[model samples]
Target: MPLNPEIEACFEEMRDIRRHLHTCPEIGLETAGTAAFVKEQLDGFGIDHQDIGANSVLAIVEGRGPGKTIAFRADMDGLEITEETGLPYQSRTEGRMHACGHDGHTATMLTFARYLADHRDFDGTALLLFQSGEEGFGGAVKIIEDGLFEKYKIDLMFGLHNWPGHAENHIIVHPGAAMASEDRFDVTIRGKSGHASSPHLCVEPFAAVADFIGGAQSIITRMVSAHDKAVISITQVHGGSAYNIIPDEVVIRGNVRTTDSGVQDLIEESLGRLADGLASIYGVQTSFAYHRKHPVLTNSTPEPAMKAAARVVGEENVRTKELPAMGSEDFAFYMQHTKGCFVWVGNGMDSPVLHNSKFDFNDHGILVGASYFAELLKEVTRQP
Candidate 1:
């Protein structure tokens, strides 16, 4: 399917919005400016919006008759890095940038807002979710807590991400387990601080932490199935200030990612056991803290509504999953509550990777994503 004139024009509008957002990058949950921009766009199309979760904008596009209420969400947050792309529309705010291409995501949703509002001769409601704090702090969960479902009464939800690595427009999707669960860990070991010159005088926590970090790796390799993939990365370790003396306590922190929930359970259970045995052997005290967040995103099937829309965009542009990435996304939170699959829109091969200072969202994908959103509405909200 070739691009329609309406879709082509949407890309240009997206460029205008993207450049404005790129110049002013804001961070964290307080995206007042960003949310305001989205609200303004919806208003321009004569659509109504409701504010929820501090900075989140939720709008429902009510169509002609009754049908399944589908939702489309886009995050509105930026990273802490400064822009280095040196583009004419580069970020003006120092030490702040839309390095993750959220500006692009927001722009695409706005374009959809315009197109859908203009073509509202359909059935059912289309909910627009311009959410806050996707980078962290559990934004989606908060939106749900703020009565997202109760208000919109969404039957299905959909999300899209701009992927850098795959062939520019490959729309990957997995029926189940598209992303993993994220778990963070903090481990501390306490020992007797003593002079390094005196051998065996101090129960060395530094040595004990080192042993535990290494053992943490083995837990995945030895305990989990060989076919399964799980990672335990001890990213931070702080122990001693002086080489001459052993520190009384050593702190180690890391994160865990796994596709399998059973593996995550084993990780926590095994870590508890390992801590007990290590403390007894080294004659030191051990403490552990772990947080499990963002359950896996499992799509029951290729969202028939989204897939039909993908077909309208041509086979070459739409891609099904061969394999999925390990990186987690908060969109998973919405998918868990509704029966919809998150799709990946291409930002071209040469575009900067997400979160990189040089990264910028490819404007080429703007119309493609918007068209998908529009086409999805036509399919899902059609005459009976």
Candidate 2:
């Protein structure tokens, strides 16, 4: 599909910006350099912007008349993985890389910012949010705490990511849940320590640990409904200090993902109950802590996204029935307070999966994503 000619014209500059960001990848909430670069670009475009949240940049583009306020967010953090893509623009920062395509997302948002600056023909305000710490750093929450919703009466918001394993021109929109919620848990089982040979004399905590791991799976199979989707992964177990010594306490850590809020609630409650049950049955002291890292990303207002995507790619290329990804995104937190949707623009059918050392954001996504946001601006601005 041919992109908007105006947006297509910005491809070279966009690619340059994306490559520049790829070289100096920043991680977590420490995105000062990246935010400075974004602010510079906004200034060059004659757009008004300010610092918000932890090192986040928010730019404003006013329209011709009064209408609803819309927002576009792009994450600006990289991962701890080293870049192995071998591109000339590969990361210069060791032990950090834009493996998740946040660099590209930032570039796309910048492209749209430039376009909106020259042509603010819509009827509402456009907020260009360059967010930081999206890679599990609580950047979005920090921004909310910093008064994102309290300051602006935003009517709708939107965010997009480049998705690999699909055609480059494809645009995927989920009408309901787009990404799963992330919950982390730690289970500590305490018991008596003794010699390894004294199996009967010592209250080994591994028995309770083993039972908790097995019982955690039952929560999904037996407790959760068959129609609901959920996963409980036991990622870590730390216990023994020596080869033969029975440790006094065993710590178990795991992750949970679900598309439904009720299922999230169910799994958390069930895991706590199972931990208590294991303690009572094995005569061990158990403590469980569950932390909700990110909420489930639901498309509260998907029609505007669908229409905007149809305008960018062809109607046939806009997919609305894709299953929710098990992966989580901090953008989900914004959905809880506003009306909007998160979308996926295809990176490429043969591209490497996200967060892999070999992964790189497909540069063509810059035009595709920018065009979609431009169209979405028009869609929301016309709303009552």
Candidate 3:
């Protein structure tokens, strides 16, 4: 219950900003409007900022003297989900909404930036990244390509997401992997099409598709070790249009998630092998393609985050025992270059899960998140 008084005082303004951003939801890297709004807020607070990546806004705050430069990121893009929550500040966009709570994240960062404006006596610099295109968009990659890593000498980085199914006052930090890596695969099975009545005449592709689907699950259970975690989900399957006619080709698409890179490589290799096996066994031509989207988000330094969380929310509320999420985050890309950790602040126990149509970012979370970030700034930038 002990939150930063300055951040607590800005709750109403932070709520207003969150609600305003919620009303006009932007998607992917096309967050020109959202980035503009964030820049406007930074201007009001007299913080120096500039455009980076596609439309990501990066704000710089210089401290008392030179030390470890810490960076904090907040994703600003919304999902392509229609708002079903009957809140008055519901999304005005027809097919887009802030279902993932990025609005709240941006608002919380802005509130913390406001606090930073008044208090900058600490050591080192603070980089506040109001990034766009976190929803499967290469926003983080775009920023890096645009010279984020080259221009700035960042010593440490940090980020947070509002997670459902936990208390609002609770803070969760992972000891190692915080989120999974995302890989997508597609298998195309090609065969001759012929009359359904004459089964022997046509080389059916459904048989190969079935075997591939079943074999995918085996890759997780049989190939992957029991201790290591991985998931392969067959999300899409497309085949013949007519029931009577055997299709010439059947396409199967699936998603892969894993916490370890070695496991990721194993699953991708096993899936390709399974597809090749189908070609030999079913006498059909098979093509397999795999794409690695995001890498596993491993927390290199957990002690600083854990200490900061315990400082804001009591030690009992700062959780470290929970399992790492299977969900993937683009922030993992940032961690690949620098040392940092991503923590999850509870939205609320009753809050709707992320990406749900009815999901909304809990307002109370903004206060706790900003306060935690304020404390984290102190924790990481301490004179060592």
Candidate 3 local lDDT, 1-384, one digit each (tens) = 379998998899899999999999999999999999999999999999988999999999999998888999999999999999999999998789999999999999999999999999889999999999999999999999999889998999999999999999999999999899999999999999998998789888998999999999988888899999999999999989897999899999999999999999999999999999999999999999999999999999989999888988989999999999999999999998999999999999999999999999999888988999999999888866
TM value for model 3: 0.98
Q: Quote each prediction's TM-score.
A: 0.95, 0.98, 0.98
Better of 1 and 3 by TM-score: 3
lDDT of 2 by residue, 18-124 (tens): 99999999989999999999999999999999899999999999998888889999999999999999999999988999999999999999999999999988887
Candidate 1, which segments miss by more than 4 Å at Cα? 382-384
Model 1: per-residue Cα lDDT over 1-384, one tens digit each: 555468686676679888899888888798999998888888888999999886999887888778879899988899899788999999988899999888888888888888878787877888888988988768788899898878766777887888887555556666777777788888889999989987488888876887898899999889999988688888999888887988899989988888777888999888878877889999999999888877766666466644654665676556664565677888878876778877777777777788999998887667777777777777666666
Measured over all alpha carbons after superposition, the RMSD of each candidate to the real structure, in angstroms, is 1.6, 1.0, 1.0
Provide the lowest-lDDT 10-residue window in model 2. Answer: 375-384
Badly placed stretches (over 4 Å) of model 3 are none
Give me the overall lDDT of model 3: 0.94
* Model 3 poorest 10 in a row by lDDT: 1-10
- What do the candidate models score in CA lDDT, each in turn? 0.81, 0.94, 0.94
Error of 3 at 226 (Å): 1.1
Residue 252 of model 1: what lDDT? 90
On a 0 to 1 TM-score scale, where does candidate 2 land against the true structure? Answer: 0.98
Q: In lDDT terms, how accurate is model 2?
A: 0.94
